[model samples]
Target chain A: MYIILFVKISDVGENTLIEIIQDLISSSESRPDFRRKENLILGIGDDAAVWKTESGLEISTTDTMVQGVHFSFAYSSWYDIGWRAMASNLSDIAAMGGAPLYALINIGLPIDTDVDNVKDLYKGILAVGDKYSVRIVGGDLVKSHIIFITIVIIGASSQNLMLRSEMKSGDVIAVTGSLGSSAAGLRVLSGALTNNSEMHKSIIDTHLRPTPRIIEGQILAENGIRAAMDISDGLVIDLNRLCNSSGVGAIIHTDKIPTDRRLKSDFSGEEILGWALSGGEDYELLFSGPESIVLSVIPMMPAGATIIGEVSGFNVGRVSVLDPENKPIKLNDKGWDHFKL
Target chain B: MYIILFVKISDVGENTLIEIIQDLISSSESRPDFRRKENLILGIGDDAAVWKTESGLEISTTDTMVQGVHFSFAYSSWYDIGWRAMASNLSDIAAMGGAPLYALINIGLPIDTDVDNVKDLYKGILAVGDKYSVRIVGGDLVKSHIIFITIVIIGASSQNLMLRSEMKSGDVIAVTGSLGSSAAGLRVLSGALTNNSEMHKSIIDTHLRPTPRIIEGQILAENGIRAAMDISDGLVIDLNRLCNSSGVGAIIHTDKIPTDRRLKSDFSGEEILGWALSGGEDYELLFSGPESIVLSVIPMMPAGATIIGEVSGFNVGRVSVLDPENKPIKLNDKGWDHFKL
Candidate 1:
């Protein structure tokens, strides 16, 4: 909290990359969070991690976070990079309604990289790991240009793992937090909202430290929710991915899209709706189930899950957004892409 | 075979390091290696790997290979990188008398890395994985100035994992294969021996892709061999490590160090013995057992295991070499390190 942690991708100096990295990750290895299971035999110091899996089903997922491509070094810290890297993968497992167990990280540092940067990045990685009770096992260290991170997460599903294709026409759609804030945060970072101090902190925080919706994922899945996924590629695109994968369609109301505390309509509801629809980087789980089950879980929304849309098979893949006048407006599909560079 | 397949720590480039890393690992989400067992699934993919273990001991080790520092980039190709990566880890598993079940790889790629280099690296990785029946379950990739690789192997042992320290002063010493070929290959690569055109192919082959003695490790373990380790940091340094680890001493005969058929030397047997003792990268397994059980496996060594020394309790940390008339001579500690850059 004392220091704002953001590194500009463009300015990632190679001269001290390694030492910085070593320093960044050192803290994470030293201290762990509460959610770590007991049998994490070897965390960060060995050739590979050793684990003991109990009876539940083990699920695994890997994701890469690249500088400039995946995130802007503009106002991001090594910790931000580390946090989002693991958060993204954990989000995937959460969407499937699983309890995360372990993670292995690989870091590429540029020459002249300071060992401290490595430790800082790892500090973020370990903070997340500890929060989830996932132990930092074993990993490798090497140097490279433009920092690249790949995170693999292993989790356990108490129930059958949820798949995106299992949703039916009548399921109700819900999300584990508000959207558009992260995109707003990015805009502020790019200097579009350069002077708005209040809006800046709220939005920037959303972008810099997005948390995975692991808890809500469990609530929904344990209660029979079968189709879900993390919303990384704008809500509109992600909803379509889920519906299409499940052979269903959906109709979402723009008026119902959630918002942060300060958005008093400087932009049209439609524009804000579009941000929620096409903007990405919100590691929130989006799930759908029966209307009755959704209502029953509303009061118990696990610190985040907010109802955002409804599942109507008639609108599969083509998400229809109704404005205040209940009129359908066209939305664009723009999400993050590694190839953008 | 014209090019050895591995990126030495010396020849690391700067480029799309992460993409090339994709082919090296298997889809952990695909499924478990077999029917699920009740154990702690500690770590997966992230910054550090984590897991929990109960009623089990932890074993740890690390190794590093550089371009000119540890290998010549000219003869070493990506395949060699991949194979040696797996082979080196598997050798460690064998030394512990454990069957390798899982492996995690960490790779460093420079920005200029090509698709083929990446794929070829994975092919080598996968080939070795298949050979050892190891599931290339998880790993990470990054860009770096030097192409450095670190592989962490995890395996299970039904009995006490073998240690180098268990050898007593009277225990017999043995090696699994001939030495100096890898070193000779390095010598050839350095332009020290250009005229041996007839032996070029064989020597290079010997140096480029040396297989680890896992089967022999099994033989040693099943037949009750106690102290063991792979001869990677040279027989001299590695033997010193084992002795130091087990709090024991050792002495070896000069004429006993294994040598290839094409090898020729004018120096006394003790000098040739020096190269065999301290020249690293031999990758053969060094082990000790009761002289009686050692006799049973004598004929079983296809590459042949030679008795070189006996463990000495009072001299636990000392590695002494005897000349033709049993005269002692000073030796060099020729092991590899990354900072050699």
Candidate 2:
């Protein structure tokens, strides 16, 4: 007689797969950090989950990371992929100057994927959620041809919102931290760079676990700064989007742009500037407001925020950079575009 | 020199794709039905969308449908796919006896997909949202190897929640509507049955566009029927789940199960019973309560809800069907399993 003893995911099916997820959910729920989510009425294992919210405006945003397009197992662990996925969505909440309270994740993976790896990915997600005090409320898992993670974060803010369309002419433009680290790290991961220095290691870490400037964004909103966004696409490209939304223009000074100084030792000045201008996924806060408000808020910034430009009205929907000699330079190269063939 | 003209999505890049999505977003936002969502403070633009919630427990649930797993392009129109995606998530809210208020969608599609089809898909989504008064608040779109749609719905309910773990022994088991219709529809779509009959057409439509028993669920909740869930995974499978959750057992009357009468003409009783017991995806609400309360609430049901059985305590985590002779019959087959090889 022949008998089947061992089990694969296919052998046990979706119910069993969900049972596995239930274990993870329970573990996370029992953690002291997660147990503090008093607003949660129900977590998982029901028709739907429930939570409570106070009387205030709530913020919500969603972001997704496709396996091949966003990360690869060859260069990133499942944990990094999961961590980065949460970070991307959290950054959007941070940009709104809100405190994240809940998160919903939707994951699609091939059936043959190792279940242990999937658990590790969820652990990575919970790690970030624990840090931000965001509860993992509920989500869905489906079979897919390619692996992807989609996260939606719900946050709350009682203060005045920082809208992209609120920037005005003469408002000072500033960024929370040095740029180009993520792009630099990508280059190294892609084999275009061979540097193994400590600085390069930090740059790589920056890409793998980019920090969302939630506190910085909150400071900006609380200090009367009216317009802000997290830098996901490169500076020039995202700034153009901000300008278009606000019906304004910008002129950024190259000398004042806060780029990683370590890049200058190994790369040309133009290359470093190019990365800062068009290399995306920095996950840093960019804000514009009245000069007085922005200047006053700078001292409170963690990374010593630098004023790199001013909102311009020379032409709506136009952006330019100023060189050391004060010559206006137009750059044609925008940041990453996934659909570009 | 070559001039680029008549651009496809791949030719234009992600930014242009976003522009196309923005047009769809604006059109949906401006719709008269959607305009009535008064709590929407900020919709679709900027970093995070904002909305207001009154003091109440909110229901949140997420569901995902992958192209080849939950649906197929060969059998379903983009409109059907979109409608079903929203329906699946809304059904969760219905099962919870809640009114859906806001939704977030995360879609993954190939870059070569036609833009018009994507717009049609959104229109289908909006159609359901309009009917259910669900606001399309925010979403994310990314390129993928295969298509998938994930929807997260946030709903509010001030009534007592219907929990699966709250059922009691001796409570009458009931369903909101007839079962096996969706399974019959799937058979027709799969070419296992001829589709010339009106009954078959209705069955096919049932498979494509399921109507959630929201009113029935609300009535159940209001009538003090504390235990309920949507019958997504067929009667026997879902009842087994309910029994396991409540730590009890049940015995359903086979003759009392309200299956489609039209199926009897083309299929055997066993086959029809098999579908009713194990074919899944009906999206009908199933509930259990004291016989007196259930009978009182039956007149208020929208689709003529039927009592089919009674909760029992024969053994925990077990469910059986009773024949006309009162002989207990064990059923082994569950419903659809996406990961089943």
Candidate 3:
């Protein structure tokens, strides 16, 4: 077989992610052939690049969205794809309590792509940029077999940045909005929409118009709630990650969990429970903080938020699904894994 | 007749660049789909995102080098491609006088790709990263039709970051190294390499390994350089942009221009002059400073460096070339364009 390796020579899609990433990390960065600059404060580390900011503290992050794997323009509008790219990366900044400022988009379009389609994609990107007051300054456009958008967002922060590994024992766990709407939305868009049409409307919207919890992030940081991350890959899986990173465990209460009405009925309490655990695209914040801070912020969640669990010390990472009597039940680890999927 | 407006879609056969970056970026951080944190100083922009140093001042930038467009893996080894990507983006950060610290990479792989090929490519990326003391902390990987490597670099700066739009009138102009070698290399690699094997070594190296001007950026920033940028895009285009942005004009001495030896016999001084003005990938520093500062730095540069030009007040926004007798000589723009060859 004349197969090319990590440089993308697949006739069909490939699935060797970890192996490929390892190779990329193993490469060199030196080149004596060219003159180099020395002002780069940080070239390639951390959640977002930390650069020198003359005005506000600038935190930068880049996200790449590709067709087929990420979304299908077949069912999703060109505008939706564009908006999704900006919104998702924007959330990363918001998670760190930064104000969005500028964005650059590097896009690859297939030759068959229509000009209107390209413009529509930009329209969506610009819409999101306009919403956040982020300017689209520069980017690259190229030809490719598929359509891809690489977005870079630069924002400002004054407070200390939040990291995933800061959750402590006795901290309350909460999430903004409801869970499973987006994961369910994906099902519908993928032509597997199981819920009724009305339910599908809300579900699809949840998936298509995911709202980054920027305000919630600011409030949490302001109130001294430090440990947090967006729950895109199942709440359970993400909570497990946050807990593990912080060296803690979580006890999730079945009744206290938030579920969109679409999920509340179409899926059983247990299935919904499972979905809540394994469903990706929740787009809700799963955060842990001191009880006092939670109390002060309870009234501030505009659409109502849920305190689903608490952080506690555990030898091995574990999630407790409690009954009314608070007994533990086994929850399946069914969250999205790009590799296995 | 529908046609893509960009180039670099051909095959040089090292690794094909895939377009999976689409969903990856949109799904990361936060969006309507996930919870977000709020302390992020920057999400993404410029060479890298800027963040309030968890401790000190820092800056960062990222560039994605796709196969075919950035390098031809056939003539240039995988190691060279990795070296160039690192040098290219780091050059941007270094241009601002930031200290290099970390480098992160996201690699896209094709499933059938060979293990050895992946190893060589990464070794190149690593060689450069380690030389600069930049650690590779995190990255992502996925299957793609072609190979695309996106590199993020973090840097540190104690001084104000450099801006390209800050040049002034009467500032002396200078370049750190010779120009046209890269394009000359391109000429050879693009089937122009006949029997002139001995003469084309520099041309080959110039194309495969244009260095990032890290030291020059620091020196200039430290020495009070308000406006500076590396010569990636051609000199005429880039300089035109600089002068236009700073609201000034510029003049260059044709005899003072530095170039590869190959060009001397093939073209007239004026023709070669045009190449110096436009043929890019020189990876040199084209910077402007006060007359005194420019003269002072002349002694500091190796003989390779030259004072080929100076900022002018003769016109509000134009670049004029002066021949040996100091008379203006009109020349056609000969630099590379993205859409053009």
- For each candidate in turn, the interface RMSD (Å) is 16.3, 19.3, 9.4
Ranking by lDDT: 2, 3, 1
Candidate 2 per-residue C-alpha lDDT over B1-341 given as tens digits, one digit per residue, 9 for 90 to 100: 99945433234332333344345335433544432434443232211222446675666778889888899877789988988888877777777677777777777777666655666577667656666656555566677778889888877764477777777999999998898889888888989976478888888899998887777777788888888888887888788878987999988899999988888887789988888888888889888999999999999998888999999877887887899899987677644555544
| DockQ values per model | 0.07, 0.14, 0.13
Model 2 chain B lowest lDDT segment of ten: B41-50
Candidate 2 per-residue C-alpha lDDT over A49-154 given as tens digits, one digit per residue, 9 for 90 to 100 = 2244677666678888988878898888888888889888888877777777767777887766665566568666765656666655556667677898988887
Residues B1-341 of candidate 3: C-alpha lDDT, one tens digit per residue: 99866323332110122222233334432356333433334333233444444555556666666666666667878778777877887777766667776555666555566656666777777766665666564455555557677776666775465666677877888888788777777777777547566667667777777767777777777777667777877787778767876788989887787886666664466555665778777778888888777667656654345777888776867888888899998767543433232
Name the DockQ score for candidate 2: 0.14
Query: After superposing candidate 2, which stretches have Cα over 4 Å from the reference?
Result: A1-54, B1-54
The weakest ten consecutive residues by lDDT in model 1 chain A span: A41-50
lDDT of 1 by residue, A220-336 (tens): 777877777888878887787787677777877777778675755345565566677777887777888887887787667765666666777585566777776889877665444
- lDDT (10s digit) by residue, model 3, range A86-148: 878877776665677656576766545555566668767766666665655445566556667
Give the winner by DockQ: 2
Residues B1-341, candidate 1, lDDT per residue (tens digit)? 49745443333322222222322222212234322333433222211122334434333222334344444467688888777776776777667666665555556555555545666676676566555665444444544445666565555554544666577778888888888777766667667665766566666666666777767776777778878888776888788877886788888877777877566642244444555777667778888888887888867866678888788887768888876678876776545433123
Which window of ten consecutive residues has the lowest lDDT sum in model 1 chain B? B42-51
lDDT of 1 at A280: 84
Candidate with more favorable, higher lDDT: 1 or 3: 3
In model 1, state the lDDT of residue A7. 45
Query: Which pairs clash in the backbone of model 2?
Result: none
Query: Which numbered prediction scores highest in TM-score against the true structure?
Result: 2
Report candidate 3's interface RMSD in Å: 9.4
